[model samples]
Target: LSFSLPKCDTMERFAGRVTVYSVVGCPHCNSAKAFLKGLGLPYCEVDVEKDSTVRQKVKELTGRSTVPQIFFNKTHIGGNDDLQNLVSNNGFFSPQIKKKKKNKPSDLMIPSIPCFTDVKGERDNFAELILEFKSSGIIKSHGSFLKVHKLTFSGSELIEWLVDKKGFEKDQALNTGKELMQKKFFSDVSGKGDFQDGHTLYRLIEHDCLTALNSGKTAECSPVLAAELSEALRRLILKLYGEHLSPDGKTVDYKAMENSQTFQEYCELATQLQRLELKSMTREEKLAFFINVYNALVIHGHIKMGPPKNLWQRYKFFNGVSYLIGGEVFTLQDIENGVLRGNRKGVGQLTKPFSQGDQRLQVALPEAEPLIHFALNCGAKGCPAIRSYSAKTVDAQLKTAGEAFLEGDDGCHVNSCKNEIRLSQIFKWYKVDFGDTNEKLLQWVAEHMADSPKKKELKELLGKGNHKVVFLPYDWSSNSKD
Candidate 1:
């Protein structure tokens, strides 16, 4: 049988209620249960000895054979010492839960272009255009014009767009368009010609263009834009002092990151990115850009200030340095919440899309990719390993990273013998991003681990979704070089 916490809407639901597992004649268990009664709190007492199943389950769930184990809304608040500490910290009052507000129509009304309907050929053509853009990393010429969100390319540009953006290594990109033209997606001068001259241009049928763009799910910003930034940072890290993932996959070499030349070069890149026309970037580019920027700035912060000695100091690290981007100064939190996480209302983050038309927002990505949690590194031992992200392969790369991280002890621990699964606190904090519930999360884990050794075990646990998912306590120690 499986057991998990019931979903509660308010802190009031658990305010006066508690649970304790104990033995029939233990003084400590009696005192703990009595303490709850003294506070006028309602509680259920389970005699572990009476039910061997509960006894074994409790042992596996708490990693302890002793009782009285206590709980509030399924949150394991720990034993006697932990109980007293909780009371001392907040006078025995449970923390407040902020209610999520209802969303309105106005909030949901995002700007969108029209979608193609009743025209399979047009849809196919548009799909090809998006695929072409994906393979080619070159920016559409005519300066600042591509930023306007229209596809207007010269004949010559189409060849490179196909070869570069679409990864056309085997097929002839030039002839592919000719084959597509028979499908009626493209048009030449007066609707007929052998493609030639500066005047010859390929354009998408302009009907609800944004809708068409949205349907493709292709990133608007050139892959080159994201690739350039990744390469730049990669070069700096490699040239100054090489960086490597630790054996535990949790630490980085701090001394290597603090190279003066590397720090200086990063500062320039940071400033340069800020000054660029970032507002016009596509959703994929924005995601790639900010991920790189956040990771880079984090490394820069460490190098400049040395490693933060404590959790308080690490948080303050973001507060200490303010980098200028897009004519505005941003702290590390701003990029994290404002840009990548989309700062949705009722989430306790500042309410505002970091930039207008940013595709990273929840409205755009809908369910944000949870794998991103494993892709971004916050310079903490518990954080995911740092990696270069590009628009071209960000999605696939994140999946790979997520799998690698889970394979490590720092990210996941499964004890089939004990019937327990321990995961990083990231799963706890961003539960919604992963599937909004533990059951769904387990399904996701099972699906992603199809090729992993744990596949069979996870599959066996499928409908039984009752397994406990305990988030291991986060370690805030510096993950830098010794």
Candidate 2:
């Protein structure tokens, strides 16, 4: 069943009464979300890592700063397994969301533009535009593609108004427009023709479109744009991969890029590229830009050890297309590995103890334990759930991913009877976390299941007659990694 969270106005109803204290790096957060959804109970999710307010509140409430901390009608629902037990015994919520009210296509999706201006100009009317898509039933599944068309149009219209109403050369503006579209490192097919003078494209894509679309633009493009964007997006995902990136490999330090104060600088670079009159960049150029962003983000996500803000970079998903990387038209895997040249870290690493051996100026990726184990969707039955944000900054992405990890049941599956255990294959592959013993892992799982009837069942299952454990086989087949 599909369920969206409660919005701002109604959020207070979820506060101390039933708020969930979660950090971004835990997968259990997502599962908590899903669990709550299953029970039809609405909750307010505060990313403790991202939101200081929530962090402070959580520390005061739980005394600990971890994630997937849930508060029911008023009591603490605990973490993933805790919530799972709540679900098993029927205590998580009162009901599922009143069957989602029919949605309008025009209300499909609203691009949440990143507020990055020193002084805001006439912002493109993003709010009004959404009504159009929602009027259409695009409850807008998957990536908000419906909004992409509007983004393209909105960007183009803004650019046109800027050029015609503001007096800019048509040719230069059009080229500038192309550059802006290219800058997303994503495709801008529909808006291509509209920004011929470069100015139109520039005005809308940069000031109007990109800003308005913020992190939401990628999901709204057309099939062509979607294909191009996904391909472009996947290209760089390779960069974030680990040294030993095998289904069977242990966690590798796939350091994604670090956060910088030079975000505006990147925007300027896009403008410069536009002014260069670099005729429509070739497919290779487009692909290159996408890869550049994807790789940078992936590397950052891996090293940070958390969830990617954007869902795509969290997991390596290459739906149906394949691209030529390094030399061959490598699937996502080769491209990911291609990022690695000499050391375990990859080409540009300079940290001595780590990769290049230079640690002074280094800002290691935070922690990706969350996303790798949870957020990135791999089409696998149990792969992590991809989110709405972009994994542009690995640190932020990893934190969000981590939140989802600790919150989901995938990592620690409590049996139907609550007596036995079925943990993720990751626990087996990376057995060190559990003190090198199933008993230890079982002990840990028992903590979350502490007050539940499942605890009795689990203790009975493992300690009683059988004295046996069933290791749930992981789904190694999907994730569209290639």
Candidate 3:
């Protein structure tokens, strides 16, 4: 007689009420509400298209004009992407039921303990397994092309060992290996393909192994290193501002900067960044350090490589410029999308700058900080003004910058009669950072704007709802003092 493993029921429990702000004819809104229903989650849907007052209320509460904005217990959860990300990553609501299997042998009994409970627990178990594998003599050095040496083992060998020694089925063993790989325990030696049960060779990542060895204790930022880097970068930026920037901070004299002794000193100092210990930085320190470095790097790239003149050149300029920091090379794209934006994938990019095994991933912020859009200057006339930031004052400085930028006509414009608001293209490009919807974007703009007639007008329009959003054309001319 055939017998199977016991069936298990897993349920996802949410702690609060679910609400969806929707609009008529919004497919995403419909799908979002449907997803909640499918999961047996009861949600209150507010069709903003029908009620202008409710639309205004949603704009005030969540700062979003888009439909399908979700909330759990009154906490804003953004649009469909935000909802999906929350559900997938945070497990906000989950429920599953499975029927029990027929009687099985004791040897085939399923363990009550979950294979992996949490990230920390999984890492601990994977580390122990690695040590066990080492003791079992399954992992060893192998020769590859060009007489290169790699400490690795075949996928099939690991699966075979698991099936025979650990009593796991072949398929189960294969999946377990893949999970270990996903957790960054090991990877294909050539950095190609996923974990597979074949002759494919895989090796444990050294940094991951070291991390596991330390009992998963994350590295602490060195105060001395952070201070030194910050001070050096600050001095360079200040010197540039004093020497080459226009009094208004709107134009740059790149030609003069390229020929100055200060530029040489700046170049030499940048080399020292190779020793920057990212782990030694606090959030404030990191924000200040990276912002200054990014601004300085823009000037450096402009002088050294010349300003990018077209779309392809702009791509190359952003993606190719690099600095060796902490033994890793970081490009302009790396600083903006990887470091500042918390390792998010940038526009026109398929993946994040830092991969799973990359040491730099440890330096990324827990999430993207929206205020950074105001601090980063891309060496263009339309970009925000450059300024040196201090760890103690970065937050205040960014707020000041945001307010200053929004006060300008180029940053924001309001037309009460037309019910239209025009914003800088920066808002358009990094919409996700701002709020992911027109309503939220406008709310953010209004909030950051200085106390002015325009701010009051925008607020009044938002309060009434049914307004439109337009992104101003970006001025890409070089911020040159010609």
Candidate 4:
């Protein structure tokens, strides 16, 4: 068979912790801080001015200079305005993926290439992003960094998936990709809006491999590295790509990945990654592990759900949604099944991503919504910001994920003036899941927000001491692509 969907697929782990950074005096910084505290969150704050050298160094690392500069796990969620957007939307409130975090990273090899004038230079180097992963007395690295993707799918496939399924058009996908790719190019700490995206980087990188496959062009970068990465990409495609034809749909024997080097390595690593039992893991490790499991499980859940949302990458599937996990078609339902419940697959079980927070590792769940919300991509607009960093340990990854989620619209706090203050339906739909009473829930919510009619509305509802939060509809639109 050229290609066919597997009968089943399984995903493990779900949810993760979060991390944040801010300056002392800045109002935005103060707001960000007060808001997180209102959410009953534990964060690490640094005064950029107190340590002059540190400020300079932060500027250098993330490639910018700004106060109240922040990072959500790996994704740079931008400043206060950006964070407000994350909370404003019905960010990642379901079995669906939240578009909490994602940014345009420049081609690391492309600093030599100059971009158009439209792209802004990054203001704050991502010192906060990196520091949150391993701040003293905060969380430490208790998890391992791991890359779960097969590097399959191309810009075209990604574009189609995002445009058709996730609600973006070709230009939207292309434009966003350009911004993110641009960030990776210069290793710019800031996003691509600062960096120029008007011009295409397609021509800059070596197009030999893609050219052969008729893959079109990429941007300028290290010719050698581009060529190497291109070859790698091609190999990744060949190795991971799958296809199947249906002539009246005669069932063909589906072939599973057979002893592939990378696949085996991934499987083995996953084996080790999924078995933490929460004891050995540091606080950080637990968070990362859960986030990884959550992310992978989300992908698995969508597949097992019987219908694909067509939001995330589709090149990895056989039919519109045809991949196997465990022995049956995998779906979000199946993925969710693994949560709180144990799955035979090394996933689901909390050997690595611990739900329980450990005081020793300087980490705690702290209602740990932001990290998991952001790190795990659910193909939505309100999720956390996704970062470029590949999580190794569950703790660090989850912390990063948490931060990204909060930084994005999905976080508990967001701009009322802009979001139109529709309390996330999550509160209403699963009001009981939030807290004892409306007051309790509002108290919890107050932890993340400053004040406004939105907060007042919530307070009014919560003050009534009712657990019935108004149902806010979830936006299923995938955050990726666009």
Candidate 5:
């Protein structure tokens, strides 16, 4: 592909690093500095006038008394005039890519491209997005560069993913990827490895891949290369907002969260997610997707209209605002009802389906997985702690979430002395989803709590069939961390 480098006085843009040592009140030094600056060449400036020691050091190194000593990526070139002559006569600015072997992989036939950071043209925001992915640990280092680990993507796939992620036009996405590869921000390391064979694998050469790999303490090694959208978003959430569970076990710092840059970024991502093709996504992907949407909407919706006074107030906000997906609009009610829960009228009555709302919405899952009650965050004091969910491990994750929620009094309570049990309002609200009666709910809870000591105690108590069951009052107070 053809590429253009931003023009300097007599040469195109320089890709490598530059260092300049200069003294004050030197016209040649000033001119040389201005020339580099105008070309958008990044450089390090060392003032020799203020530090005579540096002057002596430069003299010893270059064996010259010149005030303006220039170095292109540590290679010394003579003063202002000499620099111009080198640029005009020699190809000092442009570096060539090494050719591939004769038997290159078919999938990786896209010619080896360089990084985009060195390019001089206007870059799209997608470049920034890719960098964000890099910093968030989504993109990892491979060999001399960094790449989206565990996955290989073509330039077209990269374009589509970015377009969906940022809600950009298809052509704009294509241009962004092209520019990144052309400028060398993203490098085409196509024929590097057997795993990468036949795939257009672009490596991010700017970041030290080893450094990112070594830095991970909490990062689990996934066998796969690129994670699904759910996993990607999960990693971002964990890195940014984190699972800041409350010591009180009931409150979230909503005020601080609402003001955080992470939350703002989440809002942007969530908006783009609405435009993504939900129908085409996998069941696990859809489950993880809607959960993220629900949780994010809870944070964003509250930010739009302060914290609610009661649970009903929160419901009002959810109903008032509609979220978009695949060029269609849906409310929170529609997501929970039509999409997730298969059009159930209410949580307590699964058989009775909702009569009103967007009927066009398809059920994201074949059937509503009841454990979702423990995974959905309502921004309420009694809601479950927010955790990143991955489509690949969502079943395990949901199981863990349910068990943790059930361990608390808000979800389940047992009184050995009175032979009685009290449960969270969730068991009462979504009785149909869990079971038709308290006994059924207890059995379901037992099924989830297996292999734990609590299960043995619950089983013994529940077996008596004489224990009283009561539902605790639902807490409506905001779960804001602040």
Candidate 6:
């Protein structure tokens, strides 16, 4: 099919036979096709894997074995990157179109196309936007489609909300909704159509619902008895750790967890959290429950929105993504700094997580537990290992966790020659919980460490005064299984 270029000074009319060489399961190939479709251009796609001869021809012509070698009227255009660069530079329409010498493409600016990169940040941002829609009463389950009840909203309503609430132009909002649909964020209720600006009912996927609870939805059945719910959460986390997490908890198979039946069950079970009575739980029970929930929630967040890539993304991830429990929403930041840390302000925060009037404050511990630094895993390479905690054995479990983390190079290191000790950044961030001073911090570390040569050295160093404390840089790389 012929395609026309937007109005340009030099090129009045343009049409070309666009073709794309592709293969199954190639992400870049799919992106190239989406880019073309977004531009309203129709192209012929050839699967090179089906025939050796065509594959050889492609390699010979492009001098590359990549599947997505695009062409315009048989003129080679390299791969996905080349197509984007050509378009962004306004050099795709004609040879006679002069490139402006003064307006060279900026090295810092990368051309972006809709659905080009599966950026976890954008997915997360979109998910939060959808949650906002739900909270604003824009999305509801009150409508019936084909005599069957479904949690859904109309496409026009979504587009309107995006435009009015998010400040997106009508066209931009439509494209944004389409991108969300392609990413499986939501789908037409009948499972047969793309997102459109019309009265078509669409439902958010099951996994997306984990991030936010229904605005006023409560359990129809008697709350799964607290005992049963607690036990189920414990068992589910244990199963998840056994099947998808490494023995040391440094690596996680999030991809496998995403597809497992256990995870799906966990998602279904999370809804029951709304009915839980947190005030009745003992401190030990709260410790175990919050720790398990925190670790599992990190994995759940990763599966729903990809792992955070930078400090800002991490900030959004820890503060934005959450689960609705006991009719309250608890973000990763809330559970850690609010409940587990006794409602103290977390690192880089200006105020406490829970206010005096907030209901969540009732669940906060009287004081921060120091050992929790070792039990809480933030899905980062430098974070402590993950393990299932049981209320009956939580104290012992946390002690073990603290000991295990201290033994690792990432946790503590002593350089006697320099009269200094290097410790995990966790100590620096929550030094108040540890002791609030270098001497006290060292003493606490020395006392809690397991009996080992390093522990002995740390103790000796602590006894001797004038030792400098250095906190190692925390690694924020994803602890994902390759």
Best by lDDT: 6
Instruction: Evaluate model 1: give its lDDT.
Output: 0.54
| lDDT comparing candidate 4 with the true structure | 0.34
Error of 4 at 82 (Å): 8.6
> Which has the better lDDT: candidate 1, or candidate 6?
6
Q: Each candidate's root-mean-square deviation in Å?
A: 22.9, 18.1, 23.9, 25.8, 27.4, 22.5
Candidate number achieving the greatest TM-score relative to the actual structure = 6
Clashes of 4: 120
**Model 2 agreement with the true structure over 1-482: per-residue lDDT tens digits:** 01122233443433323456653323456556666666655565654444344454554565443566765433455666666664445453323211121221121111222321221123223323333332433222122555433433334453454467547576655565455444332233332443343322222222233221122221222112222333233322322221223332223322212233233223222222211211233333322333343333333333333433343642333311223211112222322222211112221223322335322112222221212333344334455543323233433444544443433456555564545566776556444434467787666556543233545666667665444455667664432222
Worst 10 residues of 6 by lDDT: 113-122
| TM-score for each predicted model, relative to the true structure | 0.48, 0.32, 0.54, 0.31, 0.49, 0.55
Query: What's the CA error at residue 403 for candidate 6, in Å?
Result: 1.2
Cα lDDT tens digits for candidate 1, 169-253: 4247666666544333344423446544344655432211322111223222221243465446544543343334343233456
State the TM-score for model 6. 0.55
State the local distance difference test value for candidate 6.
0.70
**How badly does each model clash, as a count of residue pairs?**
9, 101, 10, 120, 22, 0
Residue 185, model 6: lDDT of 54
Order of candidate numbers by TM-score, starting with the best: 6, 3, 5, 1, 2, 4
Q: Score candidate 5 by lDDT.
A: 0.55
User: Which segments of candidate 6 are over 4 A away from where they belong?
Assistant: 1-221, 224-231, 241-253
Q: List the residue pairs that clash in candidate 3.
A: 12-94, 12-95, 63-439, 63-440, 64-440, 65-439, 221-279, 221-280, 221-281, 222-280
Q: Give residue 222's lDDT in candidate 2 (0 to 100).
A: 17
Candidate 4 lDDT, 1-482, residue by residue in tens: 11111111110121222233343223355566555555443444444433344544454445444445555333455555555555635433222113422322221210121211111112323223222222222211222267321112234543454466557777886665555344332121211133233321121111112211111222222122111222222222222211211111111111233234533333232222111124344434344434434344333323233223453443233122211211122233222222222221222223422223312122223332432333444434443332222223344434433333322333444333333323554454334434667555556555544334445655554445434333345665532111
- Point out where model 5 deviates above 4 Å: 1-260, 347-360
